[model samples]
Each structure stands twice: as C-alpha cells, then as structure tokens.
Target: MPAPRILGAAAVLVLSAVILSACAGTPEEAAPEVTGNAQTPTAAAPEPTATPEPEPASTEKPTCETIISESVVADFESLGWSAQESPLYIGSTEITDGLQCMWADFEGPAGDHGQMYGWAPVTEAEATDAQDELIAQGWQREEDAAGVYITESAETVIAPDAEGYGITYLFGEGDVKVADTKQNLLLIEWPKS
Candidate 1:
C-alpha cells in the first residue's frame, strides 16, 4: 500500500481503538458521602394520639320484665292497685341507667292515678345517679325508710326498691329517672288528671 494511505489507515485504527476502550469501561458511581456541615434529611415527627371519651355508667345485666308473677299482681291488689301482667315499654335513652317498667293503677276510686315499677341490673353509680336525678327534679326524698329510697312530689312518687335489688317504683307524673341495664327496662307511666 501507499505510504499516505497506510498512515491514514493507521490513524483511523488508532482512533477506533481509543473510542472502544473508553466505552468498554464503566465509570464508578456512588451516592455522595454526607459531611458534618451537610444537612441530612430528618425523620418526620409522629402524629399525636387521640384520647377517647368515657362512656356513661350502666347496669351490667338485662332487667326487662317480660312477665309479672301472679304473686306480684296479688301484691298490687293487696296494695289496692291493679297492675298489668305484661310489661309496657317507655322510651329509652343513655341516662336511664338500664330500667324497664310496668304499670299499676289504683283499681277503684283512685283510678286516675297509678304506679310504675321498674328494674335494672345497674352499677351502684348508676342507681345513685338516678336517685340524685329524681331529687334534682324536685322529688322530695321519703323520710326514715329502710331497704328502699322513696321520694314524693306533689303529683308523683318514686322509690328504688331496696339497694342492689335493681328495682324501682314510680308513682304519678313525678318520676324523672329512667332505667338502665342489660336486661329489658321495666317501666310504668301514669299521667295525672
């Protein structure tokens, strides 16, 4: 081959070799090291936990009166009152303390007025709260009564029949406390004329 051509070919070959060598080798790449002066990303702060509201006190067991015993009915009769064998449900709410009720009425001359007996397996706090509510609503607590806390108003009377028994009595329109328990609430309502 001619000298110029040989020189030109040699130059071309050398350029191609240089380009291949450069492409064949990979450059080392790594994340840059953080220095003391460099600002490192901080972890985000944890969210605040929320506190839950407390639930109201309630009776632990159901206290519904599905059936009123014959003796109980007779007791009403002895008391000069006529009671329904079946329970009648009044409205329910959170503050009732789990009470279910049934009604009894004066059979003869006092027919216009009646009594309501209810029951609930409630916590002590619940029962006390109910009694407190009645007194707060103008129900005068009965004086010197053992085994029961009775209260009276101008047209109503209410009592918790024996502590821890979960039984209550409401007469006339004065009863403001409601029943609360897991059991059905036994309630009675009699309006005054």
Candidate 2:
C-alpha cells in the first residue's frame, strides 16, 4: 500500500475500534463457507444444514460538510493551508456521516507539505486507545505551556485534545478531538513540506 493508504488504514482501524466499543451489542460474525461435498462415496447421507449468506454492506455515504464545519476549514486556512475535500474509503468499508478533509501547500515537496483531517463517531475508551496507539507507533508524547502534543519528528507539533488527539506522521502532524458524549472522534493530520 502507498503511505497514504497505510495511514488511512490506521485511522480506519482506530475509528472501527472506537465505534465497536460504543455499540451495546456486537454484530454477528459471518459463517464460513462450506465447500466440500455433503456425502462420502460409501456412507449413508444425512441432510446437510444450510448456512445463511452474509448481509450486504450499506450503501450510505455521509455528507462530509455536515460533519466538518466551515470554521474548522477556516482554522486550517489561517495556518496557510488550502482545504481539499478528501473522501475516506477502505475497500468495501467506508464511514458514512464522517469527516475527511486534507489541507496542503501544493507547491511544496512531494511528501512534505500537507495535512489531513478525519472525524467519526467513537466511545471514550476508543478515543483514548487510538491516542495511545499513535504514541506507541513512534510518535513522541509531550506537554508544554501551550498544551499536550504528539509528533513523529522534531519539526512537527501534533496538538493534543484540541477539543481528541493531536498526531502527526512523516508527512505532517495533526490532532484528534472527541466530543463530550464520547460518541465521536475528530482526527487531524498536517504533513511536513
């Protein structure tokens, strides 16, 4: 996978974990497909049990503008970045009613001048776990007069809890914020250029 895809996958996993945590009941797992013949060459045959097919994935897609506010886009713009509507998707799974935006200086180096932001529903534990996972994955955690921060490199400062988490990767740094209800996660990433 490309670098962006990997980061997207991580974000997706964290989002999925948090959403899973918030659910009152777990979803049913799909049964394995049975491929072999039901009867043997010389044995008396018994009736085989039928297995139900898995449910189809939902076709819903979120209107991102509803989840990502104009003010938030302005915030990035204030920092000299241009907002780009980046839709988030992972194979067949995707976030409906979620936020996916990217900000960048198009003139900068190939992998050095942009940021990405994402938001999705999540539980408190899920949000916390996502923060911990980012730190564990080589991003350093720090606290200062300004606020808490996490960074993948010295030049980047990933702001913490701008309201979830602040995390940055090789390309840029960003933050994550969770709503008070513990039902949403906002992820921000600003790549270096």
Candidate 3:
C-alpha cells in the first residue's frame, strides 16, 4: 500500500512539471488575429493642400497722337468751338487755297512761330487759274526760294464768308500733338486771343 501511494504522488508532480514547461516555451495564441481585409490602409491623413497665388495686372502702352488729339478737343470744346474735319498733313506749305496745315515745334521757346507746311494737289491749269485770281485780287506774288510759289496777302479773315474750302490747323511738337489729334479728333489749331 505505501509503494502505490508514493508512485501516485510522483506521477502527479511530473504531470505538473510538464504543463508548466509547455506554457513557458509555447508562444501565446497571437491575440486572435483581428484581420478583416487589411483594414483599408487608414488613408494616410490627406497631405494638407497648398493655396495658389493670384496673377498680376497687365500694363499697356498708349500712342502719342491719341493724347494730343484728345487734349486739343478738350481745350476747344471748353471754349465753345465746334471742330470740323480737315486733311491730315505735316506742315503748312500752301500750294492752293485748299490746303491742309500742320505745325511742328523744334527745340524752341514758347510763343515762337514754328515751321508750317501746307499741302494741296494742284494741276498746272489750277495753278495758273489760282495765280490769275490772286493777281486780280491784288495779292502780290513774293519771290521766295525757287520751286515754292508764295503769295502773301494781309492775314485773310477766316469768317464763314471765306471763299474757299476751310483750312484745318494742328499745333504740337512733331509726335505728341499729332498723336493726340489722331486719337481724340480735336479742334483745329489757331492763334489764341
């Protein structure tokens, strides 16, 4: 009876040792792998977006004639003068009663008379007719540099009663005045009171 009891106790101790050893060596049942289709890779927090910059404003250049024309128009309009269309030309050289006049001021003082050129297409017959008419009217032909037929009369009045097509006069430095006139359709240039 004593031998059987001792054998039973020994068997129990060995079984306990075996259970402890297994627990120590074996890895834990890797917490029930909570795998569900690899949790849609937490969309890496969307990178913060950058704000865009605004565009710059545009700068454009304006022409010279446009400026001069506008200025003349404004000045005349202020003085109650209505402007009429006239032929466009450079300076005031007169070949006929019908001429286009433009003025140019080279480096000079204010109030100084500048060069003027008048332009008109005059046929030989028309020229002869004009000369005869001027002679009849007592306008003496003044001898000038050859090729330029100059006839001077007392300052001809520019009233509505004048006999020929009206004249258009422009005033300015070569470029700026022309630019303004072309742009603004300004009034004719004339002596200011």
Candidate 4:
C-alpha cells in the first residue's frame, strides 16, 4: 500500500510541471496563431477639412441714442414724444447682445404712438433662418430698394367688424424696425452697420 501511494505522488508532480509550463508562456504563445498576411488597424486616418473663412467685421456699434438719429429724436421731442431704452426686447426674443429702443407719446395711452427698434448680433445664416420662419408664420415677404419687409396683422381693439392692427418688420444690412405695426403714420427706420 505504501509503494502504491509513492507512485501516485510522483504522477501528481509530473502533471503540475506540465500545467506550470503552460501558465508561464508568452502572450503570443497563449493567443491563437494567425495564418494570413492580413493585418487589422487599431484606428483609422482622419479626413481632411477645408480652411474656414473669417467673417467680415461689423462697421458700427449701436446704443439707444445712436439707434435713433438725433434729428429724428429731436423732432419727436418737439412733438412731446420721448424714447425709452430697454435691456429687454419687447414682446419677446430679447437681443441680449444688441440694443432695444422704444419711442412713445407717453402723454397719452399707448395707442398707435409706440414704436420699437432693435439690432441683434446674429450671423447671416441665422438672420436668413429667422426671415424664413417669419415668412412661414404668415408674414408677407416684400423686397424694395430700402431692403426688406416682413409683415402680418391682427385686430387690437376687437371692434365688431375691423380690418387690421399692423405688425411689421422692416430691415436692412442687419437691423430691424420693430415698430408697433407702423400703426401711426410715423414709420421708424432701423440701421445696422
């Protein structure tokens, strides 16, 4: 029985040596061997891109005073009309990077004596998109020597049978005349440099 136990111990040692030799093998020896000359890349090369052109510089800076010509402001003052500057754009979509100016005859109610003008620092593409969206929203697109006009109208007083209230946007270069629908005869012009 002792002789049989000694033979079994020797057999276990031989099996352990074979297992150790396999465990200590190199990465290449452990991995399955490839049979072809084909090779796989870890990463692909990037495609070439064109150099982007720089945008042209803006020619003017706007402010409440500069937005409206001094002479026009003076004329309005003579008529008891005063202009107010707002950091917030009226009605909606305020231009934080630009100026918003509103002129009104504060002596009386708002009525048709209110006009707003604004200029935002938007790219040409953005302006085009805005114009397109405005047109899609039922605003008519009209072209003229002065530039462009996109307009829509609604009723304000809610008369029994009324026509239009007047909502218009007149723009050129990159400025907007956000007047109160040009409701009054005095139409304001917004300039952008």
Candidate 4 backbone overlaps, count:
0
Summarize candidate 4's per-residue lDDT along 1-193 as a digit string, tens digits.
7998999999999999999998989644233345587554434345689989998886666665666667877877788777777663423355456666777787776585556655555555655766777776666677788657666634332311133535555556655555445443133433533
Per lDDT, the best of the predicted structures is: 4
Show the lowest summed lDDT stretch of 10 residues, model 3.
175-184
Candidate 2 similarity to native, TM-score: 0.30
Error of 1 at 100 (Å): 3.4
**lDDT by residue for model 3 over 70-174, one digit each (tens)?**
675455445444323245332322343233333433333455232222324455554555556655665444332223232334364232113231222222222
The TM-score values for the models, in the order shown, are 0.30, 0.30, 0.25, 0.47
Candidate RMSDs in order = 20.6, 27.3, 27.0, 19.9
Q: Which candidate order results from sorting by lDDT in descending order?
A: 4, 2, 1, 3
Q: Write candidate 2's Cα lDDT for 1-193 as tens digits.
A: 5999999999999999989888857645445445595533443445699999998775544333334456766765676676566544322224344455566665556565555555544444544555576566665665544334444433344443343333431211232322211112232312111
What is residue 141's positional error in candidate 2, in angstroms? 2.8
- Stretches of candidate 1 exceeding 4 Å from the true structure: 1-69, 74-99, 103-115, 142-145, 155-193
Clashes per candidate (backbone, < 3 Å): 23, 18, 17, 0
- TM-score between model 1 and native: 0.30
lDDT of each: 0.44, 0.47, 0.38, 0.60
Q: Which ten residues in a row have the lowest lDDT in candidate 4?
A: 154-163
